[model samples]
Target chain A: MKSWIEKQKYIIDFTLSSLLRRKVKNIGLLILYALIVFILASVMFFTHAIKKEASLVLRESPEMIVQKVVAGRHDLMPLRYRDEILKIRGVQAVEGRLWGYYFDPVFGANYTLLVPPATTATEQAETEPMRTVVTENEHRHGPEEQAMPLVGAETIGAGNIVIGNGIARVRNAGKGEFILFRTHAGEGMPLRIKDTLSSASELVSSDLILMTEPDFRRFFGIPENYVTDLAVSVRNPEELSTIAAKITRLFPDSRPIIRDEILRTYDSIFNWRGGMMIVILSAAVLAFVIFAWDKASGLSAGERREIGILKAIGWETSDIIRMKFWEGAVISLTAFLAGVILAYIHVFFTHSLVFEPALKGWSTLYPQFKLMPFVSAEQLTTLFFLTVVPYTVSTIVPAWRAATIDPDAAMRHTGE
Target chain B: MIELFDVRKVFNTGKPSEYSALNGISLNISSNKVTVLTGPSGSGKTTLLSIIGCMSRPTAGRVKLSGREITSLPERFLTDIRRKTFGFIFQQHNLIKGITALENVMLPAYPLGERHGPLKERAMHLLDRLDLSRKAHSRIEWLSGGEAQRVGIVRALINDPSVIIADEPTSNLDTKLSYRFLEIVETFKKDGKTVLITSHDPLVYQASVVDEVVRLRDGRLEGEAP
Candidate 1:
């Protein structure tokens, strides 16, 4: 083995130079390998980034929010509950929420306008800053829906409204422009677009519009004393159980929601999507394994003879195995890097083009999200395992066989 | 020394259509001698060579190299033995068409694990010795049959193996080229290496340097070797 290693420097040099001699074939293999790596890595990277972003937003979101049962229905909870709910010791703050939907009757495109709370009083203090705010709301696909989250405005301040980029694009309206929305009551009310919310909520953003609480209620003909839901903030997040128990007992009509609950729901969705990604990734991995197996198994007699001759000439089986292992490594690593780079570019700059297809639901989305690329250690580890490990293992058996064959048989184009 | 003691090789064993290629062939090839296994098309001459080369295993019986019984060893172990002790020159030269002459000559010894500097020097030295120094970097597709054969000879000799096995060495060569190949084999014999040449050509039989000629008929020896 020591002697073999001493010889291997020569073998590796020769293998590299020799493979280079067959530039066309090697390049062809390289491109095919790169493509596979790119697709798998991109999907994995993008999904993880989306999942992380969704979880971040979901975690910071309000605890138990109450909305009307009907789709597109925003029933007002009387402002009187502000005091009624505030009296509950666990409930730190009770604020009214107003949500409105805007539709451009011409193109049938829609936007959701919302007015949510000011998480930091300073954040919403600058009335002239024109910042867009987003809050978690029930995203309805149709009549029958569970806990699909939709992005809504944080506060209904006044005439100031916020919309999404997609809504801005589809309606051809930007900040400082009037967006006309026909509410559920079928009234065409116009409000000046103040700020467009930049969100990572792909499914929710495209059709979302935001308005001040007063503007939303006024535009929707909602009573001044009523609101769609209550945003309940607890004094102690860890004391959620005690606080939630107090709120539920005090106000049986309203539900006590913890931020974790909303986060968990979104996490489940992200998990489901992640699970699906795993399924697709597994399929890709299977394809890679099968392709590698078939390719190795289908080695022509001529190629096998080449391996034999290599062995006959004093090349060790281990040397042959190493050469092939390097080949697989080179191909997979190249592909993985390219794929990850492309995905990063797509998420950060292109907003994940591939994800757009999956993000688009049946109904028109009001506003589209700006997905950011995130790289975590766990994700990198996963990507590495998924991409490199399988390819490495895939080449093992064939490499071993090629390595162990009698050099004489190899040289003579015969096998054991 | 290469010795085969009643080596038997079978193909597709236990199947309905099983066949045996080498049937108890026994022979002893001493060092520093040129031995030819001459026979008609399917007399198992190549099969015998393959077994002697440790390219395949015997179904029964034993074969040894320098007194080491190799027939029962695992394939990889046999492969190691072959790498260190055997050299093979195929009928077609079998040079990788895409690589240069020097590279093709260096192919066999590549897996032996030598460093780049020494490997290059050694490969160049062999190519030079084979009178192929000028065409060292030229691709095999551009080399003539005679040149390719010489390269093949260079490849076989690179590892300094104990035995040189050539299968139909001169089939693609003209008479002059054939003599040149013989001269190469003669040099190896002078170096005390055992040389096994498989060919049915009369010219090979007539070579004065050949120590023995074993002819085969139907996978069996025709008579006592002349």
Candidate 2:
């Protein structure tokens, strides 16, 4: 009792029991307060987790992409630019990429089509074949299907195609099924599906369609000398920017998109979306603050009498204020912790059903993936600021007013 | 001694409904004796007791305990003085509801921030001395009228102040209980504590423990208290 901590302990003890005395009213407030915290925390967790997942998927992408610009817009880059980019001092390797977007009139959705470079005879000769090896899961398969596991997606040949799980799902096509496509010349060309891409990388490859370089070039009417862009890899990661600067200097019409820049763009998008969601939810927070203020300001008759009794029995105004402060603290903190735990479960475990639309719109291929769990000190601090500070301040002002009255007058309300 | 010099108290002063409750009053009582203030309604007995009890300030006047003026002190210092020097038993007992009798008795010392363990022991001792040991854990609404009144008395003494002020302590009590209250006041007087009481009950002022009876009429003191 001689120390400040000892004093607050007794006050907090009284506050808890006093709150229980009015449990019906207090619990109502706790539920509403926790609900607000849950919303704010859930959005924060989902946004951060999605951004982290995006960066992780981007880690495997090219170090830098050099795209040709025509009148400030993206244009096809010629294979001749690959030779110049390869001459950069730090450039490890450079390859022309063939990728484009196709819109299906029937489905009214877009698909990403890509072409994997042909594996050279020397590279194929150096690799081990999977035809002789049988994995543990192969024992469960029938003998015929296990003779050779499905051809790897990267080694598929012409007249054959590998599609992503999302494309396979929406097209209702499976292995050995033929998907017909309309070429640039308005002619129908059907390619046999080899296999659907693995679900592990589904977050990025969900809407992907892969074909051989010859089929891609012939179907899209693209010239053999031109490709979509150039994928550049640098030997020294620190010199990636230097190589990119060299590429830009050699070709003034080139735009270099770095992996880190792409990652930053994803982070900024998620942060902006999460912040906007919170700003919209600020109305609810404001309503709760006003509700708390009203609850404190309009003290019931019994409550006023209790304050009077405390003061009349030698307790001071400061003591009453302290008691009220503890009451607010207990309520707000309990609500805050409960909300944060629930939000974590919702975002990571449940996949945040309410906010799943942000991942993909109604018409797009929705990636079926779980977000990694993320919790930070900044999020908790923001929650405390939004919920605890306002409610506690609202209560103290009214409690002080009730306490500052004369004990006798407060007790009887007669101004005696 | 507890002394008052030319005390004047006006409620809502300068307002349309302003009215004087105490007018130019002065009084003194010895350090270790029991004194009774008896008066009709609106006679200013409670006002005079409140002023001397240090629960409020006087509009104009001076009050002293052991020859020290406290009339003009700030509310904060007055509260400290009140907590250390006086205990009050109101007319209605004023025990906070929803709490046990033991908690109500311990309320006065909470501001002093006394350790709960020793404070609880002291409160139990007081309740036991008043024969309220069995009812210590009972809620306020569950206690009998006499038991609640004694609970108020124990709460008043928990701070162990030098002065005890009981306003209408016997107003809600039966004759037997009123006599019991007088017996408790007799013990307080024997313990060398100053006691002031405002009451309409004859059993209080007529008790053998009382050393003087001061009366009031129409906002003015009578019978040697002036």
Candidate 3:
């Protein structure tokens, strides 16, 4: 084993020297190879990060949300639906949720307004119950506590609202500042900015505004008994599907979006994007394979001569093939590592600029957040098999052909 | 000892372009002696050298290297014989471009899988003996033809094989360089190495170091020179 390793070390050293000697001839191919890996890896990294973010955020979502469907579109749900859902066998708790989209024509963006549920305030009481509850009740209950303001002696008023990072940036509004918006009655309502959500939550909470229930109703001119949706929490998660069916049978016009269904939808969305990229990348890969095949098939006369000289100098055909194998392995592995590192930096650090627009979709208020750096061992292995294996395998036939040629004839053949 | 009986070489067999390069030729090469084969361009001197050197298999023949029959051996065994028994010098220097002369000399030993330290020392010693120490680190493309040829010689001698097969070694050299190369061949002979060369040059054929001069015409041995 040690002797075999030593032999490989010598071959690898020779391969490195040979590759370095032919850097100019190979630099273009290396760049092309690395760029292809970079593009594919970036897409994969960004999608994986986004999927992770969605799953994290989905953990906080209600198990099921029951909405009223009117004329094939979502409409406001009656508050009585929450009472009816709470009576179901596996239903643990039900709460009416008030949320609506507020369009600011000046900024040309829509901001979501949500009223905090009462249970959310109780859950966040570790930071001073009265003040935290007052502030949380003033704005919709955002998931991150750092984004909630530290309330002192002052109590949250009905006219105050907490906004997301994107909304604050777009409106240029800071804490204690006032922003004016047109209500459904076309009346100008000035709301005080209470706090800004943290940038970490920007992916999910961007363009979001949290206000008290009374403030949300007044801004949207909604009646007191009507709510946007009914959030249902199940005591037995195993019976969630059963409870959802019961809710559907009880309320025929109600549409219940289960958390599992939402997760599946998110999965399918990312999969579809990934599938599209694979289709597009398959073409590029085919072209690259053809390029590689052509380059490998037509071994340069200089290379053939080199092989011929090695053969003449007592090197066996297996030795020459082994040398060529080292050459292919070195190039492909180097390119794969370079491309993956670049993609990691592009996605995690630089926020995937090349693929962000296509992946994040076309929206004026797109989230400005960094993706968490996460790569699986499976992903690296897959990339290795995809790029390195095929490339190394592709060179074998050419190397064998070059190695098997008559040394005397090969050294004399001058045609390029 | 190297011996061949009824050696025949045909190119492009079973095709319209098939032509026999050698026809039932037999020869004997004694060990530790300098022998020269002299022939015209199409007279199969190089082809005969290739067959004797184990670079190619003869179509019909029985070849023995040190009395071991090798004509019907598989390529793997032939390669082993080529590595351990014979060293080859081609007409062209055939030094791979884009690498230093020392690297070219070390190329043959690389496949032997020896320690690079000892290999480098041996290669350096050969280069030093040939007075090519200065040009050792120079690229083959930058080296003069004579210097490149010397590098090729160093590469062939790196393995220290018993048989040195030179196919028209002095064909590309001036008289001075040709004499310098023959002096090296003389050194090999003094070291008890068998040197087999094919040359059309009278300088090589008339040299006192040559033990015998075998002449060939139209694929047939014309007989030893007087």
Q: Model 3: what is its DockQ?
A: 0.51
lDDT of 1 by residue, A209-267 (tens): 65555566667787766676777777777877787676666656656556777766766
Of 2 and 3, the candidate ahead on TM-score is 3
**Order of candidate numbers by DockQ, starting with the best:** 3, 1, 2
Global lDDT for candidate 3? 0.81
The count of residue-pair clashes in candidate 3 stands at: 5
| TM-score list, all predictions | 0.82, 0.88, 0.92
lDDT of each: 0.69, 0.81, 0.81
Point out the higher-scoring one by lDDT: 1 or 3. 3
Single out the weakest 10-residue window by summed lDDT for candidate 1 chain B: B108-117
Cα distance off (Å), candidate 1, residue A210: 4.5
Candidate 1: where is the Cα deviation over 4 Å? A1-33, A58-60, A63-74, A116-164, A174-190, A193-214, A270-293, A360-370, A384-387, A399-416, B15-26, B224-226
DockQ of each: 0.47, 0.47, 0.51
| Candidate 1 Cα deviation (angstroms), residue A213 | 4.5
**Model 2 stretches with alpha carbons more than 4 Å out:** A1-6, A117-154, A168-178, A186-193, A198-200, A235-246, A296-298, A359-362, A410-416, B74-76, B174-176, B206-208, B223-226
Interface RMSD of each: 3.7, 2.2, 3.3
TM-score of chain B of each: 0.95, 0.97, 0.97
